[model samples]
Target: MVTNEQSVAGPAAEQQGFLHQVKSFGRPFWAANVMELIERWAYYGVRAVLSLYIVDAVANGGLEFTHVQKGSIYAAWAMVQSLLPLFTGGYADRYGYKGTVAFSILIKIVGYLLMATQHSYGGFFLGCMLLATGTAVFKPGVQGIIANANLGNKASVAWGIFYAMVNVGGFIGPWAAGYLRMMSWAHVFYANAALVALNFIILLMFKEPERPAFEGKRPSPVTEFVGILFSSVKNVFEPRLAAFLVLFSGYWLMFNQLFDLLPNFIDDWVDTSGTLAWLGKTLGNPTMLQNGLAGGQIQPEWMINIDAGAIVFLMVPIAALFSRMKPIHSIILGILVSTIGIVLSGSTMVGAYCMLGIFIFAIGEMMASPKKLEYLAAIAPKDKMGLYMGYANVPNAIGWGIGSSLGGHMYQTYADKTTLAKAYMADKLHMTPEAIAAIPKNQVMETLAAQLGQTPRQVTEMLFAMHHPEHIWLVFGAIGIASMVGLIAYNAVVTRLPKPATV
Candidate 1:
């Protein structure tokens, strides 16, 4: 018999239970999430515009770097960012997380300030290194705090919340950056600096949570760093594990093309007037819309933000559906799906198709990214699972560094709209190459438009027809497909190998 007391107690107990689980996370988990969000915001804001800022002409307040230089800088930055955590994680463990986090913030502030002032390649690269170092110091500390706090049954939910917050910041960072960059590139840097400064203030209130005690006196940071570096080197050559990581690097190579090439691609190739027209018709002539569309096109950063946005909504459902699949199978499927998405996005100049491609790419990313870690954990000896998982960033570092360098050289050769325009002028228009080079890069489009008695958009279309810039897509598509195929071969070879002697 359901008495009044039992009925009232039933729902009340569940409510209390839920609150207890949340409270069990305590102060540190929430604080770490806040820090993660803000840091990602600053990082992505800088990244969203960095490639474009490097390559744009000096007359437009940009650095006017070559494609190779831009690609090298990006690749080097990614390598530093990924590798640092491996070296510095032990320092955070030995020293307190809170102090390490504060120091990292201070370093980042200096880095951003330096970036705002430096325009030369050497100075700018130094600034990027500083920023990467700061970020590397910060990531492990905050992640360590969150991981320690989410022990036991609450781990799954806590990680979910943490990832959601990350995506929130990621989406906003690029969305805001695309607008700020329009005012001036310096403004974007300054804004990111200010956000990092704000996080420093938040860091003041963070209380360090409990972590496992070290068994002995903590080694000096330099010693610890060297030891980790040696271990990383050793891991790369470790039998079947080495082969697995090498294959995994292929996916990241293709995935990174989104950031390394797509912004410049959109700026040069896509006609976003259709998107602008739709917005104008729906919202009417608002100042914000008009200012943002001054070039009669949407900013590339805004287009890229779609990937983050899609991940936020789609990841959970996609992960749930793929939960039953084998790890290797999911990874292979993911690469194929992502490759198709990349081809679709790049093969067209249409705004809608570009967005649709990113959406599909995000779905593929959801399918594979988590499983990469899962696969690593599965093959490890039970006692060494944590150590094996730590090496997961290896593929990202390798892939980004190699892929960006290669992609940049390829872009310079095949797809750079400016270079192709010059070729068209010398070949088809009967103009001297010297005269073409004399024109400012930014003015090339307008000058061509005037020469042909057409709009810049029409000239862009004409160039597409004559030069076949779409061929660049073929190159990128081949890279993605090749990576997918490489993974399949890796799986077959590794499965047949004798299981390694356990560490």
Candidate 2:
């Protein structure tokens, strides 16, 4: 037994035994992942159509809100979704994860039903708030299960699997929503409500996993919740951290345009005949062809889903490759790559090219997104890791909120074909803004095309050329590029500073 061969065998067996122990995470962790997938599907299904639903003509079963109003709504939604998790994490701890998840799903179901039926601005906003609150609560509980489960060295791989599930939901949701929305936009919301309701069955079966023990007397749950919320806000406002968050907001501003602006942009300008034809040939479904396609065109959400599809297929490989790179470098490179991709997406009205651009953007997104948390983790004190990580969401909130506002303004001023047509009419036909506003959007398009002696698409092309709405893409691209440059400067300055000596 004391021989060298026997001693080596003992260590090898111990290593295998240790791995088995780590891999023995229970059913609850897997159950959480399933819930996450369904929840994402429901959330994104409505999201894919929200911007379009807001701005379309009232006759088309839409709200027809002004760009400013749309911007405000979008900003508020982003703010709530991004910031509430800091407090909700404490709430989830105080309340059990299983009950929290069930309550969130119930709220989501009600929210979706409200969104489906309500057409007023106030009602929609209320619906959005409910959905965001439910989402904020759901996020921590689902991730908490995975984090608390003793996955050991396999945690990284487990998280990767979780992300893949998210992308799968992301891809499927929009695609299905796009089809259902063609029948009625409200159908998309109702479908999401039904899906959330279905999760109740899973909630009934899910068992809570054991949580790590907290030491010492803690504040009352309400007080503890308030404390966590304040601490997160305070940490974000710390001088150097504040600067970083502000600078990083530029990238988020540009990044979020994919959801906030791109749908409208594509609907206005892009020709989807090529994509439709390909789908027709591939699927050979006449119903899809007849009902779904307009002038041989596909829905904007279908095109947008390409980004999710790319992530689903390519993220793991891209993540593995970038794992060796520095986090800052990965972020900068990702921004630059995404800038190029977004610019390309907006450069033309071609559907195939737009798909290609989104594909490229997905590559950069996968490369940079994970590195953000990694970068924060490396800089955090061991004891304060959770707090520092909570602070990380600040830039995202800033970016999405501010970016949506700016994107709405830009869309109104530059990229809205109807708005530009009105401007052109005022300049050419001596019409006032009020006179232009009196004309129906469809009538205006028809009149313009008749006067210009071109088809409607050709008129759009002429207006696009004369006014250069695509310049908005350059504006966003410049923002991303500026962020990259700022990050570089920030890194250089930080590196030159002296390190504190460790005891």
Candidate 3:
């Protein structure tokens, strides 16, 4: 039998465990997490397949746009979505979070509908812009709720759980999209719209946390928005923070390729027959064997889902482990690991290696991504956490915008299968440029095969031998390595600087 003192101590000890910290989070915190889950579900559903959809042959129900065009759209999308939060965070603080969230949901629904209906480049671009704007507005409000949730010492646990919720949505979105797109591409957009619409219901149920009150007379809404914009910009110039964000951008530049470019890379180059066979036999699911590709290959979205799945299952424990280290050290280590992952993933045509690389990258992402936000939150003035959180996205905007543009151009010139096939037809087959251009993009490989009296696989191998598309990954890997170096240097300089004296 336990002593009375021991019994009391056991119960007290249980109260300090991980489950207790999770259970202790307030209603507002949980509500914010739920909203984030739904929002990410909708956003990532589209993102999971966007690259393939953009460049797919028109005959195959894709837009048939060039890689460069897709990159431009992504560049603009990144800037609008990531940069606008710099102001929207301020707006969330001045206005109510509930109102901003509700407004953003409505805007996102409309954006999804537009994307579903409009097939033209201009029409689709407008839809993406609308979605970006809605996301930009949505982030700061939800993050602000998390910031002011009164988490105290449990902030790391809270943020880690919130990030896990994000990956839950991220995982589900692509997994669903892989099957949904098999039916119709439009279904993906329609489903995302419905998912976003669900957030409105969530907003109705949750209470917004109390916001910090403004001093003296309240300014007009327009005046407040402008003031926040200017003030947010001013804060970015803080030497240490500014240097940190700039260096961190290189990580995002490499990070975005996993989603934006890798899908197409896998589709065009990597052989997934081995993995697909294993998945089919193990799961015994008919759908696993039903992707439209010849040889029943795995869909690219399913491959990319590995990243999200890894995070959903593993992020919290990883966050807990890294929480003990300084945030900058964790970030630097993460970037280095992630760089290795990217290089490994891109350097191979073997599907198993690619999957392993993605898993490795996910590990690095777990270590780095959450710490960036937590570091900002820790250093922020309590009342200004929302604004600072908004600033947290600046590196994403800069890196993704530049990376998409450059990565797109690189893919088009260096690695695009169709472009390579066209060059082969002209150089070896003696086909005129006009004849090559006239072939439907979807059928170009088949046409080349027929002309050369070779199977499609043989021609693909020949092109691979002639033009090594794997080099594109090396470029992206270098960016990640560079960023890691920059962060390490920044941390050293900042650590050496004398601290301001206490009064």
Candidate 4:
């Protein structure tokens, strides 16, 4: 049996410089990183604009689904994407990473095409499920490759570099999507499909990492699947790991909002004309000043892109800084910082402040996200690295599914401008529900503005003043604080427990 020290690193590696250690990770590692980059690019490209596409008025090229419907789709998406990995990870280990990856690529391609062609709610939901499933399968295969390739003590550095590559795609995908969607939303989906296909070529460039052989005759597929499911459940329920995952779910609940809810929030309330005008003047580019909105507002994707952009440039150093610290400590610190960022981002309509908050949140993300994977990888048994890594997604699944459902309800109740507008017409104008129903849902705000003898921006400001929509951030931020506190307590308890005996 290979010792933990040997599995992690050779003594000779300790003598090498950091750059040399990085280079030593070799071809398979780099190839996996590239594949990760491409995959993230494809996923985020669609994701960056999905909320808008789902909830925007049909006249404006969106599906015009209610916030509640959008939430249901996202909640289901989280379940399929995050939970399926629990089993797929074992499959990758038992079969081969290469075959799983190839299968996922095809699944993802079909998903993108469905999204592009099918605009109905049921059709689009199916598309998203397919995409999520493909992503679920894809994650463990690539992560397993990384686990096998990083045969050194610089695991933190290796994961950080991999994360930075993830942001490279994250940053670029949204930037491109911001422009592509201007032409047409269909263009964005098609573009992502093409980008995902590039991974097929990347798959050919790397050899599969060696996997452990089964000692006995392999079980039938049905038996093996059941065994994997039972084993995964048992492993997750181990008290220490279970406590950590449950606490970590709160962080993910808050983390996912930056993507799932914030885009709609920005679109409905935040005014970005000032930022757009500033950029256009600063860059001497006229195109930056126009977005078909009344005041030439900055696109929501560009605003949210701040999070990915900050990580792309800063993740490595931040990871290195926290490399020697206990993973739990880093995570606690990150959650605290992130809570502040979330509240700040959501508390106002000022575009610059929103961007600043996103940037701060990115710092917290840099500190926390990679460490979660590193911590899980460290504790996993040598032979079950892929299975354990699959387990790493559990927190995200729980958090995202719950958060999406709750956040959708929250937005619908407390913050939806159209809903508020309809209410305003009912209470203030003494308009009946039937009268309000006569107006197009997309044009409710415009109609409200006309009735009040105000511009759309003026009506939006009035609604903000009367309704206080920004309070939603406080609610989500509180979840992060609770998570941070839970993690701290869990860490204390774990630290007091006895360490396992080294063989």
Candidate 5:
């Protein structure tokens, strides 16, 4: 007789080509994708505006924290979000993905609403903690469902489709949230709650096939998560694996800027009026409901969407192009190319012609990210796939956590002249932003520049200038250069690592 495990898991075989793989997803697949999209939509929307929410002045009805303070809270949230899945994945497998997802969504709704309404910025941060817990519960459970659903030669392609659906959520989240933030900052939170509610409804209609016991054994969630944390820590100390983790750190520190710092950078530096204003014009109505919701910020979350878009537009061809290379080399090349793309994006303040630095960077991201996962999937023991998959996100969590502090310091110590200038401007002018903006640039600079003991051009050209936002570029660019150096050293070490046949 066929074994229970064999029957439940379907047949395993060599890969199917792309078009054939796309045709295989049926009703359940689409349903899962729908839920994925909504989840991402809710999560990313609030995150897109979070930095602004934390740092905006008390007069603007924001929490009014300093940049450093905001970064710490945001980093703490990232740590909890990724760290918990170490346990939650086990619970999800023991329970049901849908049930866990529903419970998490309920908690999130409460958290988001509480955050939106709360007066104390401290309370707002606590509410963020709740939201993070809910996400920690929700995210890995969904990944479990996708893993279990793939049963054959179709598994690899099936997983790829699932990733695309995730990008769909990331895309919708920022696109919708950016618009909402313009009207009421609170609306961003409310809207996330609503989308989450909608996901709960969609999940209710599906029934996942009962999982066959792997000899009817499963560990406690806390035990599994906590064990993995220590285990991953130990594993990171192993010579080869440790080197791998160190190298991987470079990828995430660069990648995470889309979340931690890019949005704030755009708010402080980039000319949103000239470029993004036209973004409003090209879309149907400039003042339409969605557009109105997006607010005035540059929406760096959309930068993440560009990575997703490249998966569709460029990843397939690129993945095939480099299919023959070893995964490690692919990662090294991917990082280098991505750094070039980063330089392109950061080097120029503005340009007369458009070049797709963001698009090119997406190409590099798509090339590396999925490959990294696939590498872990192939190498990790099957019994621990859930735990190992959860571990995969740990580097991301730590990188972004450290990166937030680093990003905050860069923006504050380096790019952040806005906080100081506004004070000096308010003291002298006694006029609002609109009135000051209405005055000729030279007049304000002429009178105030002299008082500050600098010529108008000197103040305009140097530390006081807002229009020339090259300083932020310099900060990110420097990090990218450092990352490239680290990557080069990493590759050198990897070359000395024992080859597959040698092992």
Candidate 6:
């Protein structure tokens, strides 16, 4: 029978009427949102700088990793960030959410501390793993506390607020890092350290319902993780949840690009430095000029501008608009609209096109992104909220890892690597790399070819002009359509699965 503890009236209950005792909001809700903001700030701040740090050359204080090496590390980081939660959530249940989150903050402190000093691959990767570990531990537990504390009618609004806070944190984290890194690269990591440190202190004042029976024991994350790995993996596939997870991966693949590839793309293609220079000249303060790189020529922090700016402009209004639709349809509509935007961002050689793409994509993302997890929460079994919510990251990880690998493959193939790069350049100028390479370093290939054996500059121009960038555009479009179609079919089946009676 439900005890007095379950039924007793509280402020949470006061908000609801006689028929419903569910919470609408409480002190715990505010505490949870505050903690979430700090966690996301720390996570995204560090993340925004990591890839750039890895790929930087000696001149730039970086390791100058091959694209493949960088991609592999990025993919691994994404995998760990997503997969680690499976065990960490259980460990938090057994230990205590507060303690677990505190421990996570400590881990992050150590991770960022190591990163600020260690500029090599070993040090960088160790830091990345630790960072992912901390993120994994904190995420589900934070949400878990929010869910448990606001168990009644307030849970929905409580979660919505939590998610909005997450985006707010995400928005601020990268922007702060970008601005700080422009001041000094060390400042980026220092800022992250400061944000995470705040979490450690803030959590001390936060209280939760109860720890599990094993709460006193400090569980080893590794051991606890391994023990539950199979169980959690098996849990999601038990007939009802499999289809959803499968389709959800596609959305993740799209969303992951924001974190994984967009910055780098901006680094190569954007003229932010030029724009900043122009602004500086116009303003008569050259020192005020900035690059697309936080510290250099490109200002990648502005890439976060798309996500932050877009969310601010689009999220609430879209949520209000979509208030009547099924979450699945919202996700579908979002995926389609965002995919078109993503393709437009990458397809055109122009930076303005990509910026517009991010803006449009942001609108789509605001519409769908929140509902993804909200839908999962609604459909999950009552007893397994921690397990399912923890698994919400599965899509994020899936998208990031796959997108990184895909971006690397594309970059290596077309932009930075051998065949596609050469072909793509050739498409621009009616010449192969061999032809370009054969010409003297300073000489224009077409102009020099006219000096050597080529018939005319116009022939090279004809050959180059015929190469189809449009085919490349189609490649991205197909991926988007394929994902949408898959989700449509998968959801067609998943909607029939057994869900909780109340949600």
RMSD of each predicted structure: 6.9, 7.0, 6.4, 4.4, 7.2, 7.8
TM-score of each: 0.91, 0.90, 0.90, 0.90, 0.79, 0.76
* Prediction 1 TM-score vs. true: 0.91
Question: For each candidate, what is the lDDT?
Answer: 0.78, 0.77, 0.82, 0.83, 0.64, 0.65
Who is ahead in TM-score, 5 or 6? 5
lDDT of candidate 4 over 163-275, digit per residue (tens) = 66777877888889999999988898999999999989988998988987768898888898899889888888878778888999999999999999999999999988888
lDDT of candidate 1 over 1-503, digit per residue (tens): 00000000011223335557667777778888898889888888888778788899989999988889988887898799877777777787778788888889888888888888899999988888889899989977887887777446666666666777777788789988888988999998898988977776776666777778889877777787788788767765777677777877888887888877888888889888777766776787675457546747788888877888877677668877987788788888998888888878888899879878878887788777777777876677687666677777787888889988888888887788887777777887888878898999899888877877999888888888877766776777787787788888877776776754111
Superposed model 5: Cα runs more than 4 Å off:
1-27, 214-230, 272-308, 351-355, 377-388, 422-469, 472-475, 499-503
Residue 113's lDDT within candidate 3 is: 89
Backbone Cα, N, C clashes tallied per candidate:
0, 0, 0, 0, 6, 18
Q: Over the stretch 1-503, how does candidate 2's per-residue lDDT look in tens digits?
A: 00000000011223345456435656776777788889888888788878888887776777788676788888998898888887888777766788788888988888888888888989988888899889888888887777776666556556655666677777788888888888987898998999878777886665676776667887787788778767776676655566667777788888888877888889888988767766776799775565435567778887778788887777668866876788778888998888898889888888889888877887777766666666666666688778767766677788889988888888898889888888888898787888778887657788778877888889888888998888999999999999989988887776665632110
Candidate 6, lDDT over the whole model: 0.65
Q: Tell me the deviation in Å of residue 342 in model 2.
A: 0.9
lDDT (Cα) of model 3: 0.82
Residue 227 C-alpha lDDT in model 5:
74
Best by TM-score: 1
Error of 5 at 245 (Å): 1.1
> Over the stretch 1-503, how does candidate 3's per-residue lDDT look in tens digits?
00000000011223368898988888889989999988988888888998999898889888888899999999999999888877777678888898989899988988988888888999999998999999889977888788889977777677757766777888888888888899988899999999889888887776888899877998887898788778888888878678878999999999989999999999998888777767776787666655423466778998888888877777657856876787778888998888888888888888989999988988898788767766666556678776676677788888999999999999999999999999999998899988988999989999999988998878887898889999999999999999998887777676666742110
Candidate 4 segments exceeding 4 Å error: 1-31, 145-161, 204-210, 286-294, 377-388, 500-503
lDDT of 5 by residue, 1-503 (tens): 00000101223335666787777766556677777778877877887778777776555667767778877877888788867776676677778777887888888898899889885768888888899999888875676666666546777666656666666666667778878877888899998898888977778677774554645456666676677668656654646555555557666777766556655654544433335555556665566434434534345555435555555556557867977776666666776766666656654433111125666666667656655655555445567554455566666676678877777766666555454454457765465777655544225555567667886435544543544444555555566566657756766765675544211
